[model samples]
Target chain A: MHVTSSVRPPLITGGKTYADVTEDICRQVEGKPTKEWKIAFTISVIVLAYGTACLFWTWWEGLGVWGLNKTVGWAWDITNFVWWVGIGHAGTLISAILLLFRQKWRTSINRAAEAMTIFAVLCAASFILMHMGRPWLAYWALPLPNAFGSLWVNFNSPLVWDVFAISTYFSVSLVFWYIGLIPDLATIRDRAQNKVSRYIYGTLAMGWNGSAKTWARYEYISLILAGLSTPLVLSVHTIVSMDFATSVIPGWHTTIFPPYFVAGAIFSGFAMVQNLMLITRVVYRLEDYITLEHIESMNKVITLTGSIVGVAYLTEFFIAWYSGVEYESYAFINRATGPYWWAYWTMMTCNVISPQLFWSRSIRRSVTWTFFISVIVNIGMWFERFVIIVTSLHRDYLPSSWAMFSPTMYDIGDYIFSFGFFFTLFLLFSKYLPVINMAEVKSVIRSSSEKLPAKVAGVAKGERVANPTFNKDAE
Target chain B: MADLHGKYLVGVYDDDEVILHAISKIRKAGVKISEVYSPFAIHGMDEALGHSRTRIGIAAFMFGVTGCICALCLTIWTMGIDWPMIVGGKDPISIPNYIPVTFELTVLFTAFGMVGTFLVTNNLGPGVNPNMFDPRSTDNKFVMAIELGKNKLTEEQISQVLKDSGAEEVNIKQF
Candidate 1:
């Protein structure tokens, strides 16, 4: 009954079986940390320690420690916030959007990507807290009955919408992720060799027994969650874009921001996913699961979204010029020819130009080239935010108040802090949890695995021979 | 963990296809199946086992409606009725601005509510131990359990039917 196109290359290689899938994925969770993992973990912890200290001082010394002036009140903090939030989008896109589209290749990478999403969103939220100078009064952003008066939060404000959007996104994604993890957790629980691991994984598994009734419900809920999440993901970035779009600033106010920002978010998010997954694939020896075909497929997405982002940039400039508003025209011209031209050009080259290289099949399939481009894409994305936020604000209508913004050490340190925090959380997750979704992978192995030879494939022809490897010694 | 106190015949299957076929053959032989468990969800196995489609979708839709109504009530009550201050000179009750929050709350409620209902219905929660017929059911095996008392066939007859229908191993489970 499980039919697949013979022309399509195998998603899972090495002719693996059900037992092998469990063994291969579970070994990483059950085994001791490899030397490479120890080294990587130690480095992450060191970076986190330094970042925490810098973050502490930033909180202690206050906003003056950053390079924020009246002209550029929102520099590195908002840029980092947007950047991290954009990175979080890829996880939801892969898990929810791809699920709806029936993209089977997503099974190999969705677990780790969703984890990345959660951690990235956490990092993004940290920036919002950090930007609020008086972090203690953060709860005032919420709609609460105030003691001062009967006043409530302004429901019309985009910032309040952000508060709702981000919190809802975080909580819903967490639930979706945990729901997906239950069956795989049960697998780990059943295979645990020690009492501690057994007890721990047991509680986390929530007593999943893989009954037909439970699986039926599980699939149903997963589909509904995916349906809910598609629009949720789009709305998150749309609301983020509205934060600037609703403003009256020359460059900030644009009708195209919602779609443009969403495209750019997915573009940057995929780049981040590629970076993390490539490193993870190598470190965990997961080449069989995260195959080259998977890498190539991701590259194709990168090219498509990157092209869309590129088109948006061109359209923004075209609309700015065609609208004939002197302020908006000046903003676009200044972005290309102003004091911040270096940042603008960097954004163009990195975001608009670099991902186009993925058009070549050889380069798309090359691990070295992909990793190098992914890093470049991330740098470009960060610069894109900087150009949009800083350039638009630096030269206000009044020439007397115009000033250039430059980051102090504290600004740089805070950005580093998010990086440190993200990696540290990611490393811990990789070490402790099953990076690959075991049960989901087992299900797909029947239709997408490498075909077995006739000698090893004991089943009759025309019946589904799901990568049968009856001769275990052949491996 | 609920103590299982029944005698049952458990047939272990190595492949999902074999188990799926076995469900119909064993049912045709007049033996009622108690449950079938597997490492992964076997497509069509639910229908083969004669289970009707789940109603979780209806529950999710209801939760979503509740969320939409709640969001509308919160916005209308706070922004329109309660001491409304006109900041940008727009109307005190702005439905356009309300769309984002309304949409967000709807999704939030639907996701959490449906998941909560799923957990409660499936009898799943943290620290709740499940009655696993075979531990390997979470690994690679497909296990079919039948309460011996409920079935009309003898143990030997049922075991023969299971073997003929492609069960690799047959065992007695006392819960």
Candidate 2:
């Protein structure tokens, strides 16, 4: 709202104008590396190396290198897979889904979240690719002619749909991410001082000269793509849910999986965004552009989606008891009071119970509290998948096959390697990509010009907005 | 210059009220109009200029239909026609199975169709860039116009009409 030209606030106050925003965003390349970057780079590389080492050993050793008994076949690997994939949901959800809704707040965070989606999916895929004992023959999943059993892949199977879903999801998100990056890359190309930086950034700029026709069509195509991607994002997680729901694995079987899974994905993804943004906002000296208001807005989404996940949790317990089948009943009871009750309650406390604190304004507005909750929520979600995968399998139909699963050093290494995989991609993104959509963020700086002040005043009180929050209620 | 026969008196403005006032004034004065343009499109500007709702959306739908047919034909040619097999408990022509490819083709066709139609209708394509008025028109200004000869309006009358309607500046150009 502040429109002054030359009265720039310190980076900490974050009261930057358009030109200031441009300069601040470009600061990473314009300025040489500081001590802080060195520290961050050092830590990321160390952890990343550990992660890679863990991955190499697992690939060399085999599937049994980690831990997956017949009972708990999914265990930590699938849990990590689902969790990483879930973490990916928030990015596209924020970018595509929110764009369709025209949520202006998304502009500040979408590029980073989209990057997160790409990286997190890469991490999740690494786990999937590695988990394949015969990594070379993973093509058995594809619908190639003359493959095994003279057959096309079963469309009925969620796993088959997932191959399509994940691949489509990856390409769609990648294209969307790349297209969005074009203008920002041009901005960087124009701003770069060094010859090497200019050449690399200039090529990636794709010859964009901010042509009016291109911008108009760019806006149009972005809208259409967002519309297309919105359903794709939902379908992806829904199909992912079908992976579990299609089976009769007690806690995994439920109609609630799609929405619940989508919500949890957003919740964890927002947390990861919070984690990354908090660090970036601090380190990059971009407090004004990535303001507390932006963080608060994201925190609001986290709170709301987290509670949505909370309700899904309660509904699962309610439905399990209501079904009146002993296996289902015991499944619910087993998750709570079984041998892995600690894991179950940990999931509950982290995912369901902790997010409720957001109902209070004090906590949601506090960066320190939000960052802590974001981490806890992510942990809870990972454990949530773990609890679902393990508890159900540990006591499926007979006690004879029941076994407690533990991650060997191999399991730990693969997990670490996935982390390495995630951070390595993330570090590259942070260095190279726009990191935030400068054009979109610039458009957002002026706020919605058409909004009647009376309508916007209502937002201060924190009134709950309906899904697809637009003129439906306001008008 | 052969394409310049349909000369347009495109009036550009900033305020919505001025554009509305100008359009009404021109219509009352018995002047036929062409089109209104803006940086970010303004709602109700079409109605002011008496433009029809575009068939671009309809064209998109038709393109989508074409895409579905193409998808079906291709699937049939591949799965049913060329290399038919009966591995699962399903027919090759099942629409449920065709959805993924169908949806993609539909989008691809519709998008390409819209772009093609937009370019053709607007008289633009490869190696053709139209003359621009104010540089800022595409940034935050609004534009309105009529095909000059169709309305039988003189340049002076148009200028007066534009000034009365709150146009900051007015000009005539051939592309």
TM-score of chain B of 2: 0.77
Listed models, DockQ each: 0.59, 0.10
Q: Give the interface RMSD of each candidate.
A: 4.6, 8.8
lDDT of 2 by residue, B1-175 (tens): 1343556666766543355556767788877765554433333455555655565556767887997798667655656656665535667556576566555555556556655664465544333433444334433445665666666667678768887766766766554
C-alpha lDDT score of every prediction, in listed order: 0.89, 0.70
lDDT tens digits, residue span A1-475, model 1:
4556666787888877888899989898999999988998899888888888888999999999999998889999999999999999999999999999999899999999999999999999999999998888888888888674346988999999999999999999999999999999999999999999999999999999999999999999999999999999999999999999999999999999999899889988989999999999888889999999999999899889899989999999999999999899999999999999999999999988999999999999999999999888889889988989999999987999999999998899888889889999999999889999988988888777676433433232224443343223112
Best by TM-score: 1
Model 2, residue B159: distance off in Å is 19
- lDDT value, residue A359 of candidate 2: 76
Q: Per-residue alpha-carbon lDDT of model 2 for A48-158, expressed as tens digits?
A: 788777777777777877778777777778888898999998888889888888666677788889999988888887777877776787887776666463655554457
Tens-place lDDT per residue, model 1, B11-79, is 999887678778888899999999999998887888889999999899999999999999988887888
Q: Per-residue error at B169 for model 2, in Å?
A: 17
**Any runs in candidate 1 off by more than 4 Å, and if so which?**
A148-150, A452-475, B1-5
Candidate 2, after superposition: displacement of residue B7 in Å? 23
Which numbered prediction scores highest in lDDT against the true structure? Answer: 1
